[model samples]
Structures are given as C-alpha cells and as structure tokens.
Target: MIRHILLIKFLATADTAQIKHLQTLFEAMPQKVTGVLTVEWGVNNSPEYRNKGYTHSVLMTFADEAGRQNYLPHPEHLALKQVLRPLLDDIIVFDFQL
Candidate 1:
C-alpha cells in the first residue's frame, strides 16, 4: 500500500464555503478513481501550534505505487487541482510506501 499525504494552507481570501467544497471534492476521490483505497481529510487542531500556518490535510491510501502514479494525472485529480489551486497559499505533498 501507499500513503499519500497533502498539507494545505489556504489563501487569506479563501472562504469557508470554498474550503468545504474542496473537502467534499477530496472525500469523493475513492469513488472516482481506480486503485484508491481510502481518503481522509482533516483540519489542524493541535494546541502545540507547530503547523507553520498549514491548516488542513488530506490522507489517502492507494493499492500500490502504480496506483499512486495513476492518481497524479487522473482527470478527477486535475479537476480537483483546478478548484484547489486558487485557494491555496501553499501546499505540501508527501508519499511513502506502507
């Protein structure tokens, strides 16, 4: 299995509704893409406050490396990026085999 994680920081102008919409889109990925095992979304909630302004995260599980690669250029992912790009102040992606 592969673990794919995204850390996101929203632009100051990004609104709650837009953020929620993006979350909705992300949560729908397992249903839309092949080889996607699961998708999870979350907000920063630590009292430690070490987040460096990153406010949200997406954790995804893929069946394998090929699945992860396939997800990168999938049309649904591209569409998600279209919605996500404008709202972002910064983004970080991390992936590893599990």
Candidate 2:
C-alpha cells in the first residue's frame, strides 16, 4: 500500500468558504478516483505548535504507487488544483509505502 500525505498552508486571502470547499472536494476523491482506497483530511488541531503555519492535511491511501501515479494527472485532480492553487501559500507532499 501507499500513503500519500499532503500538508497545506493557505494564503491570507483564502476564506472559510474556500477552505471548506477544498476539504469537501478532497474528501470525495476516493469516490471519484478508481484506485483511491481512502481519503481523509482535516484542519490542524495539534497542540504541539510546531507546524510552522501549515493548517490543513490530506491523507490518501492507495493500492500502490501506480494508483498514486494515476491520481496525480487525473482530470478531477487537475480541476481541484485549479481551484486551490490561487489560495495556497505553501504545500508539502509526502508519499511512503505501508
């Protein structure tokens, strides 16, 4: 299995509505993409306070690397990026085998 994790920091201009939309869109990915085993996301709520301003995270489980590769260029993924790119300050993606 593969775990695809994304951490995001929103730009100042990003509003509550946009963040909610992003959350909803990301949570729906397992249904839209064939190889997506699971999709989960949430606002940062850790008390550790070491996040350096990153405020949201999305974790996706895939059957394998090929599944993740398929998802990267999928049209649905591209559409989501179009909506999110403008509002993003910074983002980090980490992938690993499980």
For this target, which candidate reaches the highest TM-score against the unseen true structure? Answer: 1
Q: What lDDT is reached at residue 22 by model 2?
A: 87
What digit string (tens of lDDT, one per residue) describes model 1 on residues 40-66?
Answer: 999999999999999999999999988
Q: Write the per-residue lDDT of candidate 2 for residues 1-98, one digit (tens) a residue.
A: 99999999999999999999988888889899878899898889999999999999999999988888999999989999998999999999999999
| Candidate 2 local distance difference test against the native | 0.92
Clashing pairs in 1: none
Off by over 4 Å in 1: none
Candidate 2 residue pairs that clash: none
Total clashes for model 1: 0
TM-score, prediction 1: 0.97
Segments of candidate 2 deviating more than 4 angstroms = none
Cα lDDT for residue 94, model 2? 96
**In angstroms, how far off is 87's CA in candidate 2?**
0.7
